[model samples]
Target: MAGRFTGKRALVTGGGRGIGRAIVERLAAEDAAVVVADVDLAHARSAAEALRDKGFTVEARTLDVGDPASFASFDERLDVLVANAGIQTFAPASELTVADWDRVLDVNARGTLLTLQLAARCLREGGAAVTVASIQALLPNALSANYAASKAAVLSLTKSFAAELAPRGIRVNAVAPGRIDTALSDFGSEQVGRITGQDAAEALQRRLSTNPLGRIGRPDEVAAAVAFLASDDASYITGECVNVCGGDVMA
Candidate 1:
């Protein structure tokens, strides 16, 4: 567990599972004392327990990313922050509801805004921040209108934070994952099946086929990228995004 982050402290929103959990594991493995912050306190505690058993420095905390007040209670100085909490829904544009749009934007956009803003304040000099975006933000896809818009907003906000924090020596970047293997992928299968009138397996096949690698990406793969961007290895990087979609952006 001795790595670049041996003495660093990190916070990861939605760190209880999926890509967020992967990021937390990666940081902790690199010796960062990580706070697993999730709306589900149980999940957070579970993640912390697993990592703690492995002798990594980890802690559990409850954080509702959609609530601005949630960030206020977090006053710990940090070296890294991964704003990875988000939700997704699938519906045809014509069928998309206002409530759905608001919920999506509120969590994916406003939540990110608050989380990263806190990071900009809490991160020490030379600290780094990473945001979890989606390939849908850059690609024109069906059944994800609200998700795409919210992630696109994340892209813009990332740049804004990067610019504003540069003078203070803090870096801000984003990762846009495509067809990652996570709980969210199950939702993809169901939604794609509904849209294409295909069986679950067939829909999943189509989704995989969209990647030039002809497979789904892994959470650890995205976590590796985040680790790099949030370390001194990428000290010159900021306001940038690395796509972890197995070349799905090309497909």
Candidate 2:
């Protein structure tokens, strides 16, 4: 039997590692021709090569989602787009620098917009775009004001794009992951340690304690939600933000 994405072509930004890599792997496992797009060419090439070794149809491409010129070189007619490239910085409101704010928003918000715009231009009718947002958009951490605000924008953008693209037979949705075990989360954990004078592992543990599941989530778990939204399984689902936060954001 053929896989769900046997004939489909998918691209995932930041697909070199972490949640983005998991999404690429999952889609490839379903037989999609996957493009691992990342600013870090080394990671992208390594990921693509590993998947190819496993007999998956995968390739690597360099993408700086914040740059429109980068999209010009991406000429594929895509069936699925996973906008997962993002950066986070933790600072109190009083201490946050303008450069930090710009960097976070540039990658997390403007980058997402660029990805969606390119996807809209190249995606065939009935295509899908899934953006990786954050539970902080809803929970609102004081230390992550910039990150939260950028992701909130992403959530809003998803809805607006879903409405605008519905007539064109394209679906747009978002996945808000919480406390996932990835390098990004490790960075956040280290920041928490600096703020709280705790070890990184202890800081991470304390953060995970707040989750109803009593543990941090895995990248693959979030990828599963993205896969559902991208596949025919969620054909009727659009303009929604699915929270993969281990029940952290119940609303």
TM-score of 2: 0.97
Worst 10 residues of 1 by lDDT: 202-211
Model 2 stretches with alpha carbons more than 4 Å out: none
> Tens digit of lDDT per residue, candidate 1, span 188-209?
7888788768898877786687
Number of backbone collisions per candidate, in order? Answer: 0, 0
C-alpha lDDT values of all predictions: 0.92, 0.92
Question: For every model shown, what is its TM-score relative to the native structure?
Answer: 0.97, 0.97
Tens digit per residue, CA lDDT, model 2, 116-184: 898889889999999999988997578879999999999998998999899999999999999898988
Clashing pairs in 2: none
